[model samples]
Target: MKYKKTILATTILSALLILIALGVSLVVSPMVERKAEQLLTRYAARVGAIERCSFSRVEFSPLSRSLTLHDVLVIYRSPKGLRKSMDRLEISVPLRAAACAVPSLRPYVLPENGSMDVCNSITADGVSFSMPGLLAGSLKHAAISGVSADARHVRAILDGRRPEPVDLLEHAVIDGLDAVNLRATVQTGTGSAACTLGAFRLRGLHDLGIEEIRFEQLNAATNKERAGIALFGMDGFRAPDAATLRLLLSVRLDGKKSPQALDKDIEHVLPMLQQWLTATIPPVRVLAVEKASFRGSRPQDVMSLDLMRLDWLSNRPREMKTAVKDLVLPAQLVESNGLHLPGLKELRFNGESDTRDEDGRIRETGYLSLARFGQLRYNASYAVPGGVFNFSLMQLLSMTIHDAAFSFVDQGALAYIALNQHDPDMAGPYFNQALDYSFPGRDNDALRAALKVFTDRPGTLDIVKTTSEPTPLLRCFDVATLGRLWRVSATPGKESLYDQMRRLAPAR
Candidate 1:
């Protein structure tokens, strides 16, 4: 009888306990829901939106004292005239945090001990984005993996109806203390327009610091009529092995715009662009080093001239074909800068056109060859009506040597100009000044003397005798010119000519 009574009492106690637990759950369930709603409202207030949110189910566990949520979405609209459409986003966070900050659920708080996952898909008129996995944890850090976007038929309305398309792929891994390391690639193309930026890496995201970044390849191709300017191929730009103190930019213009028209626009808008870019883009200020190298390969017969290399360090780098026709500029003064260069160190040109031979026979054969380095530093400034002006300076110092304290004091001052007034004939005087400076005469002895500093071993320049009719490869300033000026001989025992040339070249 005693055993029976004890068993019966135990059964009753167990049933009562079960009922009590069920009652507590019933009461807490509504509280949890209310808490979630309140939390969402608070978040909406902070972000300044309420109608842009929707939520699914929220569940709590008593055993672990944790909360889990599903299907949380947030949508936003971008400002007018932007490229994108609606910015649709979705994220899932731990219910604990979501509940603790609720305004309606008074004195009820959930502990923070869980993780969150976010996935978003945004689509604009021409742009589309999808991120597969974005995760955050209390103990661990946040990360985004397998993120991709497709941007086709996109247009930047700010600069007229410019057609733009962009495709991006990115992935990132972060640590507990908010250290992020990421890699991404972006490619854009529209019509004949194309651009690619590959092999990008970023570290220390909060402050926008890049430990190492490389542009493995960059290329653009566009028809002349569409591009608005002469097209140049900027093949591959590599940074020095060490970290750079300054910023470098490689921009490509590939659209249906004439080079002259583009130049005019650029001339008018470059300052504004510079100001906006410097102010809006955080990365620009951190970059202290800058270098731009270019290459171009045009179809034969398109023009009368041949392609040439642009050697930044040469005394007279090869000249690029400008749209200006019949300008009557000196051959030596090919560029805006007063200094005549030897030629570009690297270049390749091929094509043929009628020279109007006396017999007037058409010739189809053409030849191509590499170009040599020429001019070093070139600078020129021109102004148009309405206070519009354009000026540029090319520094020939090598990236390696320039970073080692090449002085820009002289050139820097020249680059600074305040064109508050209009001057249309500025190009003429600048052109004339370049011609006068580049004339081959004793008048430029100071420049010649300065150039001599670049040649350490000036005597090695050998003038080999030609047995056959020597074909003119291309017109370039040779070390022989420097040697002649130094009155040095090509004798076998003479000081190393290369060393002398280096000595004659000006130090940065």
Candidate 2:
């Protein structure tokens, strides 16, 4: 009998505890809702000193610790004195993050660790925005999903100007941004251009690895004609640094910073530009663009690129290489120049450059290859004993051009010469006949004969020039000086042009 009585007493106590917990939740829910609304209202007002902000509902869910805002509207004036509007915006975020957005609430909710993991993610939907003035357009039904940020980093970025904000990005650790439906229009010298982006996504804020970003369409018009790009996209993009963002936020962003105003503010403008240019380029393992297509103002004018890739191999000598594949030029553009070819096909360019070597020499090499025609390769070497960055006038004058080479490897272009020679038995092709007739016979015999060796045969032709002595940089200003400085040699070869140049002795 005593055991039964003890059990009954414990059950009643447990029931009472449950009732008390329920009462507390019921009592606190309304207070939390009202507080959230008040904080958000203040935030809207403070954001960019907005002209106005309104919303239909402020919903807070205590169970999930999330806040949802509906039917929001914001109006603001841009730095250019243009008015902008965003309407029908819906936003959802964790309550803690929402609280952090409110300046007054920040102190109360800040984490002890200095890294406030605001939320797993935040989302906004049904966003529409418009900008008015010379550059004006509207974005329709845009959405942002899976955005997350560190509250402390946010504070650092929002609290200051310029370099501080950019520097803080290193520790910001924002990630997982997916945004879509970006559209814009801007005034151009001739007419206006309009562009639309299908999507943009990023993995992190500080490191800024772009997963995928693509522009769906671009339409540009001028007084004379219209052109457009069907599509352009990039994936796995890594920015070298935040300097680009810093420059955009600096004084250059103002609409008043036009060329005329820039000219007046030359002292200020030049230094900023120079600083940006000299900023270090981080070593990117590989950067690639898959494809790009452009349609010119005319229907027949189209250009397309298959692939482009860049690789940064080293930093000491700052070595890098770039290559393009299957680039096609417009047929109409070639025809306009009276070239009797459909177009240049499979045009490719590959280039490499490396900075100061052991002897303080810089070398650059490149080649242009055409599938139907041939390849044109060039090489240049320079000696800068003072160092690459030693740009003093004396250092520049001390620099010397060592040697240079230009070679053309014939794949099919040589056949045209024979076809151009008139035949009594048959009427030659129009392009070949016209080309032969139009080319003036102004060259001296030796020069013409030297060129004829390559024109007559299907092989590589090398034109290598070696300096009699290392030519000073300033001597390049005068053509006669270069002629006197360089001893030119032309020959047919199976070996590469640079190889031949290296083996050949300078003409006495």
Candidate 2 C-alpha lDDT tens digits along 143-175 = 444454455566654454233666565445555
lDDT of each: 0.30, 0.55
lDDT of 1: 0.30
Q: Give TM per candidate.
A: 0.27, 0.60
Q: Backbone clashes per model, in order?
A: 74, 0
lDDT (C-alpha) at residue 125 in model 2 = 61
Q: Which sections of candidate 1 miss by over 4 Å?
A: 1-42, 45-78, 81-200, 206-459, 462-508
Range of the 10 consecutive residues with the lowest summed lDDT in candidate 2: 499-508
Task: Give the range of the ten consecutive residues with the poorest summed lDDT in model 1.
Answer: 398-407
